[model samples]
Target: MPSSISVGREARKANRRLSPRAMFLREFFRRPVMVGSIIPSSNRTIRRVLDRVDWGNVRMFVEYGPGVGTFCQAVLDRLGPDGQYVAIDTNPDFVAYLRDTVRDPRFSVVQGSAEDVESIVADHGHESADYVLSGLPFSTLPPGVGDRIVAATRRVLRQDGAFLVYQFNPNVRNFLTPHFDHIDYEIEWWNVPPAQIWWAWKD
Candidate 1:
């Protein structure tokens, strides 16, 4: 997703594809509960997440379920000098691999559930994040788990913070509706099976 790292339109477009060395599907198995993708079947949405965010105004950011760190690179590129990236995923294999794949000193990868972000960050000495982006598949979560994660996110996101979530299903609106001050969608016409982007900002 780091478009600048690989110049040229063709290369940039190609860069959007999953990394050849990436263990995307295998990593998904590490935490079936959080992986939105059925693996190879839904990998395209991961690339879409990288292509849709505002590069500026992003300092300290957190990413949930950053499988293969596709969006992680884009976020780090846009981050300010003191900017830091904290990525949390339920997949331990992914957390390990993603950590090793990134070369930035400012990036931190955590192998844990998204529901524990606040505690995880506290351990790392970060109070709350400027932006929190999530790729967790919320539509099918067990009843209270979805709400619990949202509440945890709200606690870790500053008042001016922005949180972005990408889902293949529109039902996500229900989980976010009562909690967020704003919820909007960005549609991707060509993504495999097509998809919707959900943007949530705190009041």
Candidate 2:
């Protein structure tokens, strides 16, 4: 019936269904513009991005494009008992994976655009998020989508809240500049491709 290559492809697809890394690679190939890297973020990058948050005062923490729950457990671990962690992603596969694997009452995964963060937060019974994390590839997003996401992110954050972003491209800074008065960044060289971590405050 099938050729060797065809069988290999099918076998890999099956493996992807069972393996998180394989699934992430599949999604990256399926949507390179949406996924920043084929490899998941490193633990060092996760710590650098998350350390920017003031966990004690955080009531709600929102995330954009949380591929394969990389930061979910970390956020949940640091979050207060009463805090909420809501993650939004356009990738159905990622949203589904997070929903199926992350079994925390405080976490909510929505298959949607990051631009709708404001309404999404409202829908979840929160007025504003204390911190929002995103690793979406802003430099690759479709025209106008990046602008909308940054603008809406600013609107959905509390007064002292910050937007935490880790990206391979430093160009994401351009998208953040107009919305945030204060922005700082560092490079986490320990990551696969080395990531630029940013903190854009809503001051």
lDDT of 2 by residue, 1-203 (tens): 89988976665455446677878888899999898798999888888888878999988999999988888888999999999999999987787677677899999999999999999999999999999999899999999999999999999899989999999998998999989989998999999999999999998
Model 1 has how many clashing residue pairs? 0
lDDT at 30, model 2: 91
Candidate 1 — which pairs collide?
A: none
User: What range of 10 consecutive residues in model 2 has the weakest lDDT sum?
Assistant: 8-17
Which stretch of 10 consecutive residues in model 1 shows the poorest summed lDDT?
Answer: 12-21
**Each model's TM-score, in the order given?**
0.78, 0.91
Which prediction has the highest lDDT against the true structure? 2
Give stretches of model 1 more than 4 Å off: 1-22, 28-33, 39-56
Cα RMSD, model 2: 5.0
Report the Cα lDDT for residue 29, model 2: 94
